[model samples]
Target: MQNFKAMVLLQIIISIFLFLSQASSQGIGDKSNVPEYAWLAGNWSGNGFGGTSEESWSLPSPDGTMMGMYRHLDSMGNITFYEFLLLDETGIRLKHFRPDLIGWETKEDFVTFEMVRYNGKIIELKGLIFKRKSENEMEILLKLRKGDVVKTEVFTMKKINKLK
Candidate 1:
């Protein structure tokens, strides 16, 4: 019985070690071949997060940077929150703000999501994935973390000429 218990403890320890290693490596990836996000450039909106979610992306600029912005609204069309997104050689960094443009984090802090997979149509970031369903349609999956809990939000958005 003693030997069996010891073996079980050893196995648990090994499992935990492996899990920690993988978790720590989540946002680290090869940045040399970050593809241009021309497919994602446009205005996108859909139902998400208890209301409507909108995202606007800019084409790759001559300075080699892509910019985006996001906004979430309530059913009544009241602004709930906003986010500024940027993609560059480093990674995708985003900052959250309230409707009044008050930041949610410290001035120097922003959430960074690293690119993990890209195969033309599908681009997977550390905790976010963009799947191009068609030229005018896209599926976005975002992993939101709070404390020890994690939730995934799926948004299906279509390209629009402007935000509605």
Candidate 2:
């Protein structure tokens, strides 16, 4: 009887802990403490990889999620690839796809990028950086790593919409 009571108490404690943890995560996922990146909500086009790169970010929703999309066209103006991005207080989650919408990663896999810094003017992810140059110009610096070789690729983007 004593062992049964102890087990029941332990289970209750574990349940409470799990509940609190989940609640905390939800709270953090909201805008309670996340920086304002709404300025990024617009169409932006850039040049890189010998092609033109276009990206668009949506305004954050009530649930604190911002959706972003990216596509690159070759110098000949042929579509090359696409990327879908999900942004939240924690970081950015991204997935790659071919022009046909076929995924580069498995359905269960995505690339996670943690924010290194964000100060309204600049946002830095683990291996990527977004720096606002002016009201309508932004620069993107990406660090590409392979084996032991790391290369930096820079993209200069101009916001397509009238600056808000």
Candidate 3:
């Protein structure tokens, strides 16, 4: 009877351990486990290859959607180009707009990227990634491929203003 009781207790312990391991593994792949990207909501400025660049991001909503705008300027402070970004249920989408407000993409089609990986601080899109170095600093890496040539642009931004 003593041996049988000991075996039963051991089985129970093994079962609990297996259950916990499975739960943790599942959480790693669950989207709900991702942290809210609300920290990105604010005004940011930085220098890029073109010149000074500014970006504004909106707070993430309860439904999981956030909007952002980016503008690049030349040394003379003239707006060179602008980009609109959105994060939604489908994924992250980006579109370029001219100074005249003309969109580079058609109404039916636009460039989109999926979140390949996202930790609390680093978010990796398909060809782009944003790493939040600290409360006041962030880095954006964009990879562009044309034919067989690939180029990467890095933008380091500093937080200029916090969202109200």
Candidate 4:
């Protein structure tokens, strides 16, 4: 009778372990679903804050990674600054680069914005948010802070071309 009780207890423990393992695996698999914001994959241009800006985005990969490049040009069409962007399950990462390929951040450091929320057309990433206004239009809101001063900027983008 003692041997039978021990065997039953061991079986129950094994079953519970298997169940927990399967549940954890499923939760991880769900993160790979491509975000509906994939609609951002395209060439976009706009004028804002005294400059003309152009941005290009790539469609999200199966693993939920999307890449983007941005250029800010003066009214005379001279390049002012550039930015590289990445979106993934971890969050949104941004790095500023000069026209000469010099990076603003250290080789091991980049700005990260944790994803706070998302719907089919809008994604909020901490202080930065993006909203798809329509098939050809989008809006970006950025909140910047320096010591005790805070500033907010809004940019409206119009689709210039769709990604192939």
Per-residue alpha-carbon lDDT of model 4 for 58-83, expressed as tens digits? 97776678999999999889888898
Error of 4 at 92 (Å): 0.9
Better candidate by lDDT, 1 or 3: 3
Q: Between candidates 2 and 3, which one is better according to lDDT?
A: 2
RMSD of 2: 7.4
Give a tens-digit lDDT track for model 2, residues 1-164: 99999999999999999999978876745656444766677899989988999999987776668899999999999999999999876779999999999999999999988987776798788888889898889999999999999999999999998423
Global Cα RMSD, each model: 15.9, 7.4, 9.1, 6.1
- Provide the lowest-lDDT 10-residue window in model 1: 27-36
Backbone clash pairs for candidate 2 read none
| Candidate 3 C-alpha lDDT tens digits along 1-164 | 99999999999999999999988865635556434565678999998866998999886664557899999999899988899999864568889888888988987777898878765687788888889999989998989898999998899999999975
Question: What's the TM-score of every candidate structure?
Answer: 0.73, 0.76, 0.74, 0.76
Residue 36 shift from truth in candidate 3, angstroms: 3.0
Using lDDT as the measure, name the better of candidate 3 and candidate 4: 4
What's the best-to-worst order under TM-score? 2, 4, 3, 1
Candidate 1: lDDT of 43? 91
The candidate with the higher lDDT, 2 or 4, is 2
TM-score of 2: 0.76
Cα displacement (angstroms), candidate 4, residue 72, comes to 0.6
